[model samples]
Every structure is written in C-alpha cells, then in structure tokens.
Target: MSPANPFTRRKDRIDELAATAASPSGGIAEAGAVDEKPGVSLIASAWSRLKRSPVFLLGAGITLVFVVLALVSPLIAPHDPAAGLLLDQVRPQSNPVPGPQDGFPLGADSRGRDLLSRLLVGSQQTLIVGVFATITGLAGGLSLGILAGAFGGWVDALVMRVVDVMLSIPSLLLAFSIAAVAARPSQVTVIIAVAAVQVPVFARLLRGSMLAQRSSDHVVAARALGVTERAIVFRHMLPNSLAPVIVQSTLVLAVSIIDAAALSFLGLGNPNDRQPEWGQMLGRAQTYIYDYPHLAIYPALCIIVVALGFTLMGESLREALDPKSRR
Candidate 1:
C-alpha cells in the first residue's frame, strides 16, 4: 500500500476495461459479431432483395389472392358454381344479370349460373392450366436442354435446329394446330396446346444457360478431375444454370395463362357452360356481351390481372437475380 504498483494498477484497469468491452453492450464486440456472421447465399440474398421490392410484393400479392380464392372457393364463393337455371344447366335464359337479391353480386350468365361463383371457381382452372402447362413445358425443355447441352456436337445441333424450326412459327399458331390435331377441345387439349407453345422457349433458355455454365471454372475443374460428363452436367452445371430458367419459367406462367384463356375463348377449351373456366366464361359471355358487357369484362379482367401478377413476379425475380439490373 505504501506505493501502489503502477504496472499492477494499469493491468487492473485494462482487465476491467476488457470485461466491460466483452459485456452485452460492447460496441467493438457487437461490430465483430456482425462481421463474423455467416454470409448469405445468392438465393437467400436474392430472396431478401425480392422481399424488399415493391414490384415483387405487388405481383406476389395478386397471385396469392387468386391462389387463395381458388383454394377456398367452395367456402368463400356465394353459390355452387355449377348451379344453373336451365334443365341443361345452361343459363341461356338468365342473361339478365341480377342484383344481390338472388345472391349473385357479380350477376348471372346466359345459363343463369352465378357469375361471381363461376369466376371464383374459374380461378382453379386458370391456375391449373397455368401450372400444368408450366410443368409440361419445363419437363420437356429441361430434357432437351440437358441432352443438347451435355452432349454437344451433332446432338446439340440437332436439338437446336428442331427448336429453331419450332421457334420460327408463332407459338400460339403452333399450339392451336397441335390442339386441333392431337385431342378433343377441353382443359387437357388447352393445357397441351399452351405447353407446346412454351416448350421451345424453355428449351432454348435452359440450353443457353447450360452452355454458358459449361465454360465456367468449376465446370472445367470438374472435367479436369475426371468427373463423369453426366455428373458434371447434371450435378454441377444444371444446378447453376437453373437461375435463368427459373426466372424465365415465372414469365412463362403469365404467357401460359394468357394463351390458355385465348384457346378457351377460341373454342379450344371446355365448352360446357357449367364448367367454370375463365376462358370458357369469356367464350360464353360473347353471347350476351351486347346485353351485359360485364360478362365479358369480368373474365377478361381476371385473366389480365392474373397474367399481370405472374409477369410482374417473373420480371422482379429476373431483375433481382441479375446483378447488372439491380439499382
């Protein structure tokens, strides 16, 4: 105590300061902890960015509403979608769209079916066509892309030439021709038709993406290491090349929805008035369009809104994934 050890005192002070700095409120520790946190993956980062984007929000919101509407239609819808006035279930007489007094807020069709109910139930079909068409196209396209991209040489050229030939024709026309020839007009026919339209687009996109990825350092390394070509292409290249294809698939959903609707409107979809398909609804509406424009407007508006939602989502995803497009 006579002369406090200067070094000991200094050491005590340092220890005390270090304890404080290591406490819950230490600024340096907080900063260091943050720095030590794991970095986000490209997909996670893209998702985070997409969540922050108003465009993504809008698109997702619209699509979600339709999805919800479709899923819970039986509960939320005002009336049985198939409930019609005529003996044949065709509302050929109820062209007089009624008020809510009859439980039809959105009005009635020529078959006297609740327009609102039909519209609500129609969401299911619309989504079905869109989803199924997307799946069909993606399956076919992925196969072709992988085959062509992995094989190269004549296989690539052959596949690409076929794709090119298909691409040369208008997508809708090709779909229409296929639908007309292969099957009877219905949801299945329409689905196949729309999927056929999308096949070339997906095939080309995935093929290009795979080709680009093939030249990447990782791919080359795998090749150098004697990895099987199948393993390299399927395991390594395919996964990396999927980003663009995924983005394109989103955009394609919008196109598929629109195309499905077009086919229905053109009489290639379900013709039964009882079947509530947006496109079919539009087709049936043509009969009473002059008397009740709402008939045409409702289905058209639904198609437009749903398609817009997918389009927005696709575009937003594309921009989020592409660093060059980020603001």
Candidate 2:
C-alpha cells in the first residue's frame, strides 16, 4: 500500500463508471427504454387528437344528441306524431298553425300534429335516409373505385368517364331526375335518389386517393415483393386510401340529409303524412311559411343543426388525420 498501483486505481474508476451507467435510473438506460417503446397507431393517434379537440367534442355532442333522440323518440314523444290532436285549434281561415301551448311546447304544425313530437319522431326518418343513402353510395363507389384502381387503362377510363358524367350534372337536379322516375313517392325512392347523387362523389374521391397511393413507396415495395395484384389493391391501396373516403362519408351524411329534405320539399318524398319525417314536415310548413314562420322554422332549424354537427365532425376528422397536423 506504500504506493497505490495506478493501473488498479484506473481499473476501479472504470468499473465504478460502468456500474453507474448500467443502473436503472441512468440517463442512457432511461433514454434507451423510451426509444424501445412502441409507437402509437394512426387510428389511435387520430382518436387522441380528436378527444382533445373542442370542435370534435362539440360535433360529437350534437351528433350524439340527435342519435339519441332518434332512438328514443317513440318512447319519449309526448303525443302521437301522426295524430292531428290539435285539429280544433287549427283553422284554415283563422289559426292556420297554432303557437306554443300547454301540451304543445313547440306549437303545432299546419296539420295540427304536435310540432315537438313530430320533430322527435322525424329524427328517425332523417337519420335513416342519411345513413342508408350514404352506405349505399359507399358500396357502389367502392366497387367502381376498386375496379378502376386495380385495373387502370381502359377500365379506369370507362369508370371515370361515367363518374365525370354524373358529376357534370347538378346534384339536386340529378336527384330530382332519379326521384321523378319512380312510380310513386316512397322512402325507398328518396333513399335511392339521394344515394345516386353521392355515388360519383365517393367514387371520384376514392379513385383520386388510390391513384396517389399507387405510386407510393409502399405500393412499389409490395409489387417488388411479388404480392398479388388483388392483394396489393385491396389490402394495401384500398386500406391506405380510405382516410379521405371516411372523412367524406361524414360530410356526405350531412349532404344526404339535406338532399333528402330537398327532395321532400319538392314533393318527391312520401305523400303519407301518417309517417312523419322532418323533411315531410318541412315540406308542409312551406305552405304556411309566411303567415306562420314557426311552422318552417322548427324543422329548418333541426336540419341545419344536425347537418352542422356532421360537417363539424367531418372537418375535425380531416384535420386530425392530416399528416401536416402531426407533431
């Protein structure tokens, strides 16, 4: 111990540094652990962003309220939506439409049905029309998009040409033409008319998205790996191309509802007042609009609010899914 060996002291110092670095709380180890953590998926990341966004929350809230009302309207409706219980209160020459009364909170429509109850019940029809029409359109568009995207060349040209023709026409006018062909006005006809208008929209959107993704690194890699064309198109291209389509669906729901209402307003919808619908109610209200603006106001307000909710939800979703928004 007269003179401590320099080599041994150096060795001890080296061992001490190694132990410190190997400890659980060491800076290097901690950083390594973080680096090893799995990354969040696109869907999960988008969902998280949506949760924190005020616009998403507001849209979700409004959409939820309408969905709930649609589901529970029959159980909660204060009166038979089809019954003209306030018939006595409504007079053609005098009180065409009754104002808010004791039982009728929002007043009665021109037909003497409880406005509040009809509105509550009407939610079901409006939602049905929008959802069914969107689904139908999505299905038709997916078929055409898949064919075009997977085949390109003449197939793509043919499909796109048809889509172009559809898009060239004004959407409402197209709906009107389709609806006018039906033998009689019915809910089915209205759904078909609305769906036809949306098909080209979804087709164009999906086709464009697929075309963009076709030349991406992933597609090239898949093709190089000898992946089947079908698998590449459906498994890779189709799935990857769905983001914009999904966002468009939400916006389309709003559009479908509005178009259905327009069809109804133009007398292309069901003539039976027995089955109350928001659009049908709105259509009737137009007759007494000037004299009793409330008749038109209530249903009109409902359409705007519900459509606005979907639009907000769609816009928020678009922003959330945008790569530019990623931190």
Candidate 3:
C-alpha cells in the first residue's frame, strides 16, 4: 500500500481520540470522575450522626446509669427498702423524718425506711412500669396502625375517629379515667392507664407514617410484583415506617414514667409500702413536704433526671433521623 500522509495519520489518531472521549468512560469526564462510594443505610447514617451529638451522648449516659442502678439495686442497696430500721429515731410530734444518719446516708422517710435504699429499689419498679407501658402502647398502636394503613376505607376511618376521640381528651385526664375504671388501683392499674393514654398517640403517628409509605416507590413496586398484601405491609411498609415510631417510643418512655409516678402520687398506684416506687415514696412524703423537704426531693430529682435523659435522647434521635438535618 502507498504510505499514508503524516497529516492523514495524525487526523486518524485525533479521530480515534475523539471517539474514545465521546464514549461513556472517556475524556475530561473520566479524568475528573471520582470513585463511587458505597451506600450508607439510613440506620447507619442516623447512628453516625447520633454518635456525634453531645445531647445524645449525655442522654445515653444518663439512661445507662439509671438502667445499671435498677438492675443492681438488690446487690448494691445498703439496707432493706421496706425495713423500718430507723423507726426508733423518728417521732411524729418531734422529728417527723430523720436526716442523714449513721448508716442512712440519705436519711429516712417518715415510715423510718432507708431513703437511699428506697430510692435505689424504686428504680426497678419505675423501669418496669415505664418499659411495660411503652411496649403495651407500641403493640396496641402497631396493630391499629397496620389495620388502618393496609385496609384503608372503613377500617381507616373507624380507627382514625377513635384515635381523634382519644386525642381530644387530655392525656393525663384520660389516664386518670382509665385508672379509675379499673377494679382497683395498683401498679398494674398504673401501667394499664399509662399505656391506654399513649396508645392514641402512637396509633396516630404510626398510621400516618404507614400511609405515607404506602405510596412510596418500593411499596408500589412490591404491589406491581404481585406481592401479597400482608407481606408488602409488614415486610416493606412497616419496616420503612418505623423510624419515627422508634424515636417516639423513647419519648413515650419519659411520659410513661411521669404518668406512672402521677398515678402513684394520686393514690392510684400500688398501695403496698413494702414495694417502694418513686411515686409511692413521693406520695408518702406529701405530709412532710413542709418540714422535711428531702423526703420528696430525692425521688422527685430521680424522676426528673431520668425523664430528661429519655427526652433528650428522643429529641436527638429525631434530629438524626430527619433527612433535613443530614449533611
């Protein structure tokens, strides 16, 4: 063959270069392109954000301490919570309650029981009520929400109307009413009342979340794929709808603790002094409120601190989960 012109050879080379550049992976685009990053899931991303938040750290710390104390109270407590060891030192006409004495670092309640021991032991009861109440509420809420979200139509309307009615009543008042309706006032009664009060809130929140998820792309695709309605609702929609509910449960923990205390304070909780609860202790302290402020101070402070911890953690979780808050 005749030798190709140098200019023709150069043009052919340029054309080849142009074609390569025009291809998908070429030229300035290819040179500037960065490696694709691995996907970060919502849970992991939210957790990463939570780890960096001072509020979350503080809240988690406080909650952890409270939980540890509650778990180890029987082992760590100095005296029997129900024992009236200091009864000899208390005189109704003279000293209504004792100040920090020999073995009683936090003094003693009017009943002559060790305040510190009562406080420590009380944590167990407080945790039980709070956690149980939240679980009960969550279970009830999830059932109603799923029914409404999945069935729609009459099911949705019926559930929403009931929720609205419940919401219209003040939560505390509703709790009181429910507790009163019970055959007797006890720890069980307190849990039932608090859970009932929380049910509406959780139900409404979950129903709304699931409803939003129903129209999501994944849910629609699942439906188009002929996935069973139950599978789509529980497997796909429910999981995606749970972020808000999880955060709400933390906040509800705080509320349930406070509600349980309120019930005990109002003489609607466990009446047995042998099983000391923060609210029960606080209830007994009411008579000595003016003379010995410490009687109520200790339990009250504990309730406040623990509740604040849950509130802070819940708020932090909310911020972390919020897409708007993400960088």
Best of the two (1, 3) by lDDT: 3
Tens-digit lDDT track of model 3 for 53-99 = 99999999999999999999989999999899989988989987888
Clashes of each: 5, 0, 0
List pairs with backbone clashes in candidate 1.
Answer: 90-111, 91-110, 91-111, 91-112, 92-110
Tens digit of lDDT per residue, candidate 1, span 1-327? 498799999999999889978899887677677545788888899999999999999999998998999888878888888876432444345524553345666766665667788888899888999999999999999999988888889999999999999999998899889888855677888888888888888889889988898889999999999999989988999998899898999899999999999888888887676668898888877867787788899899999999999999999999989998887
User: Per-residue lDDT for 40 in model 1?
Assistant: 89
Could you give the candidate ranking by lDDT, starting with the highest? 3, 2, 1
lDDT measured at residue 306 in model 3 versus the true structure, 0 to 100: 100
TM-scores, each model vs. reference:
0.85, 0.87, 0.91
The predicted structure with the larger TM-score, 2 or 3, is 3
In angstroms, the error of model 2 at 115 is: 1.1
lDDT of 2 by residue, 149-250 (tens): 778999999999999999999999999999999999899999999999999989988888899889999999999999999899989999999999999999
